[model samples]
Target chain A: MTEQPTEGEPIRTGIVGLGKMGISHFAIVNAHPDLELVAVADTNSFLTSAIKRYTKVEVYKDFKRMINEAKLDAVLIATPTRFHFEVARYALERGINVFVEKPFTLTLEEGRALVDLAKQKGVVNQVGFHNHFVGTFAEVRRLVNAQAIGEVYHVTGEAYGQVVTKPKTSTWRSKKSEGGGCLHDYASHVVDLMNWVVGPPVKVLGAHLNSIFSEGVDDAVHAVFEYKNGMSGQLTTNWSDTTYRKMTTRISINGKKGKIIADRQEVRVFLMPGCEVDGYGEGWSIKYITDLQKPVWFYMRGEEYSTQIDTFAHNIKSRNTEGENTFASAYATDEVLDMIQKADRARS
Target chain B: MDRILFGDNQFFGVNHMSEEKARAQSMKFKDTAAIMKVIDVAYSEGIKTFMCTTHDRIGEVTDIVRDNPDRYNNFTFYPGMPYAHKYANAVGELGIMGTLKKFAPGSIISTVIRGAMAGITQDAYELMKMLVDAEMQRFQGTRTPVVFLQNVVTDLLLGFNMREMFRAFHDYVQQKYEAEAGFFSMNMPMLVDVLHGEGIENPIVCSNINKIGFRMCGGIEKYIDTLKTKQFRPIAMSVYASGAIPPEEAIKWVCELPKLEAIVFGASSRRNIVGTRDLVEKYWRFDN
Candidate 1:
């Protein structure tokens, strides 16, 4: 692993891409007691100029120059999915810890290369599968591990949002070449959570990618997955649903003796007469996120965002590479994405 | 600050406990009249201080309140600024510069010049003032005694260690709007410390303060200590912990906290509104 920073000195950090996510990360990173945000790079001049004018941190139009000049101990890459591989690769080659936003890379090959390079450099590497940090989802993982829902036989992962009810113009998110689609922009979260709670699927049984609003990309994705042990699951995601005010992800696990349904806000579990789990009733038990979540030092839209960043910071400090949502784990999710795509193609 | 303020989260489909309930609430309050109906109920119950975000829909509510001054007599609004979704949507529709030009609080040319000047002088405080003015536009022709910075921006600024922005907001609101600046944060203990460090004594701050400590960043003990000792006006939100705690216990617990200046809760029905008002009146004595 890279040499740990001095005992008292904050970890030098830089962030690339000042989009919505990037700006949020900037605030969190800057506020972190153990992180010193030295510089930021974004192509948007207005954002860069605003940062330069408002704060003392440096700004740059080129991320490469920022990495070279800032001498960052870690870098957070929130660029479009197409740029994740390039930005993360550059940082990893220089022995800098990297935290890339979700949908790790555009292709499985690119994700594999980064995973290997991160291992070679012995640097901390993580992907932004933020659901892994959500308390309810994390609780779901714990319950599944403890067999609270005994021997999960099936699962259903679903996500819905009002991202594009009516297609007006195309942004990077609506363009397929830029890795904007239901699969990458939305469903990957549910898929990653599924992979985490239930083991990764060994095969894709069927898949359908539909373009309801966008011409170049799928607005909704549906697929079935089959595990090697004969367990099966499905993914249902849509970004064009007007019913949702924001993106909501839910996972339901069906076991032989019980069932568990969970979202960001709460987890619901139902057990048969003999199926017993600690702190849960035999008939039904409900746990709200407030009960499950630990307080974060800072909270923005949600606690998961800040918690993920804090976990990354702790991993870097402790020189631990095998934390949650590592590049390796994210690559496994990427491989699942590839399987679904190939399944859809074969069906067509 | 009013001792019992009614929030607008329920009308805006922001149920922290369940997505299904939030969706149902969204569908139920799809019309402006539907939202006003609940506000009228809360108003009738003497909870006249409506702590609301400056959502576009709230602008409509403001218009109704402005028109019917006799009905809403003594009505006060505690407006929270930088309704983040509005800005996010604006950025999506109009690019960043376009959004700046659209919401820059004045004529396009003058705003452009002022923006450039702010950039050159390195005075983001001026831009912040302008944006505050822009958000406060809808609350015009009404009484806004306390204007709050939303927790999203408040906590973000707190994270950035930007103490001056807090001071700037406090000073700007006091001077221009003739109002006390309120801050909403998830981390109450940290924010109270930061505001005190900025020399803002007896500051008005709102956060989640409930029996279970749901969303209380520094935990219940630290919050209790802050409430017991800090020299600031504390307004408790999420008192029910998003429906996890029963109303009786929740109201009783928070009402007993030391130095609690106000409690804000949101409900959609007249029965729930009256019920909550009764609970507060039963436990906490409010002096006129």
Candidate 2:
């Protein structure tokens, strides 16, 4: 599902970490006419060779060398949690725009440092919270901004899965010391979505961080928070549930005038008396995946993932740091996680 | 504790009394399919509750049950929290601060950093709650009648004199997760006293209780005293005392204990599972 190039010199890009997410990034970047996948790097020789087979891109074991030599305009850091900071730092310092994967860094300090450095370099940067590009959520943002929900009173979100349930050889994602856990690995997306859809939480009222399955790494998180605007909310996330096919997030917003319940595949809205939007009436209305999802050239993965990359590329061409997803916003999410962590540590 | 609960130690390689047996069970149940097969056997034998550790492989088993809801309708999970090895390895990899950030929620991650800079830590109570939430995530949509604080953390808190966490955990599990709280400990008598100090009466505690007193902290008499007099639910685990005692004598002794509500055991084969089931049913005097 390769799309024709959309005019002008494409943003030259390099990808690091040829894991599942890294490969996905490669295909989308390679196919998009607006961007060029110039080089890829990974410690795994097998993955790098696989990329070389089809695409004649520069391959390297050292991402630093690849970035220095490839002379790319942008880079995607898709490495493990431990490497996100160093890789992003390398790219931003070199004046290359970056699209780093989410749970942006191992810690809030790393995330903040990256954001500050990226700002200093004046590069367009974004975190890979692909849910922001999902049509349903985008629609939610639009309607919420338009006051379609009419003063959202509260919100509740749940993201549950069983991705890392069994004890295996520890990876960076499974280790707490390496910034692996449900909160960083999974809830980062959930909280980012909340901040994007609702407003940033002003105070963390309460929180529960669990390590049900993994040792030190958290497999679940439950938090209660309140927005600066007096909108209260709760976030529940888990990565050890055996029930889900993959990570699935469900959000429920209670507004002064209506209510909206949404997940990855669908959105159901209920308007209060006399609440009206341009396309919606005052009762329950539903939008399924087919209704909300945009068709893309590559139908193999979530359209939102490709859409997010496209947004990042377009933002680079326009010299806009404020895309639908931004480092500043991601930093905001990092700050929130830090707050919850400290709150958990400091709470009596 | 109404239904006999199946333990996941066999699947996850955690034999308390024997290293060799633990290793063997680990090898035998190494495959997820193998674990699934035994779980099915447990289910067929009418053991509906799986009081399980949140091991990575248990997720595979949970998925199997979740996929076939019709077949495992009565299935429930009593998920135990703070799998210690996960944290130990994590701390080794991420460092203390890094590990905290890893589990910290996104919204407050920055705040956590700021607090750390200012020399403040989120409370243990809050961490306990978050840990429970983390463990409960995988058991979602299933009947999690109770959530457990595993012996590692439970006893750690006991040693630190952080009895307040017991109350916090008890409250969080009941209020937040809408489930009862369970505690697994080697020192059942001390834990019972600690919970009592927190005003937690009739608490559910799973501990090793057998005739030989194998690994029975504070000896057998103290546990027997607590079991006989304390107004709490006792879920006897390691009734075979990690196989030091024979099955029939061990089962009879534990079943005769006062307030012994349930027994949790792990077995890889159908014969052992069926044998345990028969012994439990034949000997357990539910009336007493």
Candidate 3:
């Protein structure tokens, strides 16, 4: 294992895969002063050479070779969902910190393996569930923890879009073997949010998985989840809804004291009779994330992505075991997805 | 295909409008005999075709129909496959791969190997084909002239742009099972357009066709336009709009449509069956 970097020294970072998300991470890693962009690996030499022109970083077509010889402090594997397990395992087994993208792995078995490996290696690990870092979502979580919504009873997460209204057979997203469809692509975020706010679902009550826009994979996932704390919820995500312009995720949490509805732009809270939250009396309170967010250097749309990367960088420096976006927590969402995919009715 | 097909929603307690009524129907039709009595009423009224899902209870009905050749010699079943619940229930009983192995036809050894290699090396199309073969197993030796692709799978295929599977299912039924393929979808207008685009001429489509467009997707105007122009067989269902439309108005509006070839409805009593039959007989007439 490499020795921990002393104060004022940047953490060496390498990235694999130069896809859209991969490129986004590359920009973030390159821009961050605390993290040094060391190397990148992808099959496309054009992409590799393009990055080489801008920075004096090593580029390789082979990710394994980059991991073996790069002498990196951490690696961000931004490949598809199917490759997350193998890539993360390779990095984690060598005592390198990891920041893999969402859905963790396609299945629970693989996700659990990564979580175990990260724990065994004693390295900082985080899954790219950027929604968790959103201001409104964080605020909602804070209020819920403060008993703003007392005794949570149920939750519902709806994510809809018109991305795949037609057939999409060209990419990995269309194939079930490659962790394709809405359940893995979009619902993964919603599932993670549900687990974060309400708690991990103990059971899946009913599921209606449809490949309404894609073959072999599900384009829509509508499932009912029963949480451990006597709470029940439903998750509905359709990636082929022509009615929606772009993808949007909206979550509603209903507790005994009140209800909170959170979307991208804002959070709306409605207090009930038994409300006990301080500073705010019952009726309704609206908080827009736009008003609360601070400006970042590389601001594309939201700072959540940058915030997560910064958190991962700090964790690596401090030798923190893991953060809120741990592989273990992400594995819970994978388990719920597995349960919903495999069951027709409620499963305990 | 029969002009009037009887549905099994009442037998299965699928009343969309009233949960209490659905619960009562579920309690009443808890036994196969109760379901049989309703089917008998429809049959007695000359409703010979039964367009039904491949639910477990329907297996009993199929057995009864097979046993009584004299009474139900002309009864035809338009079996809908991939009964979404069946796979889920099976998975709950067995593990996901175990359920796949169990439902996949052929010897246990080959089935296990196929199930094991399903998502890895093998294509999901083979798995879907196997699922169809498994669901169609119970209706063997019976009159299943038109095999249906349920809306759960139908609309999914539409959304995915996997038109090849539609053609595959159509070809599979025609070549292997010697049956015409039919599609049941919530969105009739879109389904018709998609089926036609796939070179499927005059595809038989069953969808929600009511006076008020209860669940008729793609809007009522598009449906009317498609009905007026498309060269396909249309089967109107949910004519009563789950008790929203008056019986006479619902049946009359649907039966008078330009390209409607059949209407499927569910009723528990002889009186309702007779009423439906008389309404169809009165409104559906030849122009020439």
Candidate 4:
């Protein structure tokens, strides 16, 4: 795009693992004048052979060989979970910037260790929690802090979609050995969101149920967290449901100024004039604290995602310039995700 | 002193007192209930908030608050739904693509390595670090005030490092809101007591995470004991789970309620309403 990778020019980039996400990354990389998809790697021989025939740049069976031979300035890891550590570590150890996918690690220790390694090697390393870049949550967070809804006393969230039915026979997901469960794959995002909205989960209580497509791994999960500020939240995620395929990500915060519900992408505020409920029967009357008029939909999508990416890039660049490419920012909220999975596993 | 929140009166159990006692110490003694009993008490006492569950005992608070518009005005309930159980995310991801990439028959399986780099450490940690970083970013300068709920899982199913587990949650939250004084789980009230007594000194937010069903259980005195060891900003909760008690008794216990900083409890019946009023009035002892 920019004629060629030039000295002091924006770094040319390539992506590995051309699944849907990988392919998207590829096109995006190529679009950047300063960046180019110099090479692409996929283990599938047939896929690699086909890609080689279609693309101008070289294609390889392995990312490591591609990185070494192609001399890439940066690599976008679109690879699966287990392979991340190896690929990321290799790239960092070599001085190549790396962008790896989410979950970072299946275990906290592993995740922590990678962070440490990133620090030691001083390479540009980042894990994608892409949603954080979106601006809506930040606005909702702003209102909550301003006591916009009053005092966020309690919070609840529901994330629903197709439920995961563990296949009868056997898949990696069926066994609880890998990161195949719904909690890790899906709820981790919710958990991360919880950390972002409130704080860290002081405690996490979970119920992992695997019914429909059951080999072993759970399909749906429900979790509750108690915040340190005396606030609390609940998050529910499902990967298997035959019904309407909808993803409802709503956070209802009962605050003081009003009742706030952050539904899907935007935040809504309701004025709660704590009044009396009408009479139900006899002398006893119920409270009429329902249907507080409020903001319905106010979405801010692009900014948050961009901010998230920029922050990672900035951290990486700062680290690189300083010869300490380790993430200089605060600890990521993901440390507890695997624990949620582990805890969910023991919910019986 | 940590912030204290009064749970619904019945949480301490109403069945313990009598109907006669209920009549004697009811709100008719002068229902000073203003701005919702809980919010009034919280505002008056300078307390923040408290947690509540929609359990059987929860009925008591709903009953009283249901009727009175004045006394139980801004009563906020901290619903304890989907209580903390435990969980884990084991087996890291296999490589992303190529023959080395392990694909599950369904979701995620095996640690597929092509030839040499098998079982290598992954970027999972980096993901967590970034997440923690981002969380802190959210609460860096929050005005509404936030705290961390320090948690411990007795039945941990994740990789061992219990301390690391605690640290992860702590650091994660610390990145955002100012870390609260302390954390509480139903089972670990004693642990909280120890952590507090040991001088960890952050105010403790009450949670029955450790206690399981705080209603059907005992050992609440773990809280009382902790209270004794060191004065806690007891966000007192779990009073309703005391069982199908009468309003009078619930009110009376609430009247006593360890008197930390704040208490937010609901009255179950007319008697409970009256008792709540009487409890506030009598305890503050004729205070204007």
True contacts kept of each: 0.48, 0.00, 0.00, 0.00
Model 3 docking grade: incorrect
Candidate 2 lDDT by residue in tens digits, B1-288: 563689888887665443345558778877999888888888888888888888777778788888888998888888888676566445434544455567655534455444332312234445556666776777778888888888867765564345777888898888987989899987788789889999998899988788876556566788899888888888988888666578999899988888888999988889999999999999988764
Q: Per-residue lDDT for A224-243 in model 3, tens only?
A: 88878678999999978855
DockQ score of the complex predicted as candidate 3: 0.01
Q: Estimate each model's TM-score.
A: 0.94, 0.54, 0.54, 0.46
lDDT of 4 at B127: 31
Those runs of model 1 whose alpha carbons end farther than 4 Å from true positions after fitting are B89-126, B197-199, B285-288
**What TM-score should be assigned to candidate 3?**
0.54
lDDT of each: 0.88, 0.77, 0.78, 0.47
Superposed model 3: Cα runs more than 4 Å off:
A273-276, A344-348, B1-288
Error of 1 at A6 (Å): 4.1
State which candidate, 3 or 4, has the greater TM-score: 3
**DockQ of candidate 4, scored on C-alphas against the true complex (2 decimals):** 0.01
| Model 4 lDDT tens row, A1-348 | 012234545665667876534654554454333455678888755345434543565788888888788877677886756666777767766667777766566655666766777667655676555545434455556666665555677777666554342354233444555556666566666666666666666666665555556555667777666777778777777766533123345556676556655543344556645522221122222111111111111101122333333454454435442321122221345555655655666876
Q: Quote the TM-score that chain A achieves in each candidate.
A: 0.98, 0.94, 0.95, 0.76
Write down the TM-score for model 1. Answer: 0.94
Worst 10 residues of 1 chain A by lDDT: A162-171
Interface RMSD of each: 2.9, 24.6, 18.3, 21.9
- Model 4 whole-model lDDT (C-alpha atoms): 0.47
**Candidate 2 Cα RMSD (Å):** 22.6
Q: Residue-wise lDDT of candidate 1 within B207-257, one digit each (tens)?
A: 999999788886789999998888999899999999999999999999888
Error of 4 at A130 (Å): 1.9
Weakest ten-residue segment in model 4 chain A by summed lDDT: A292-301
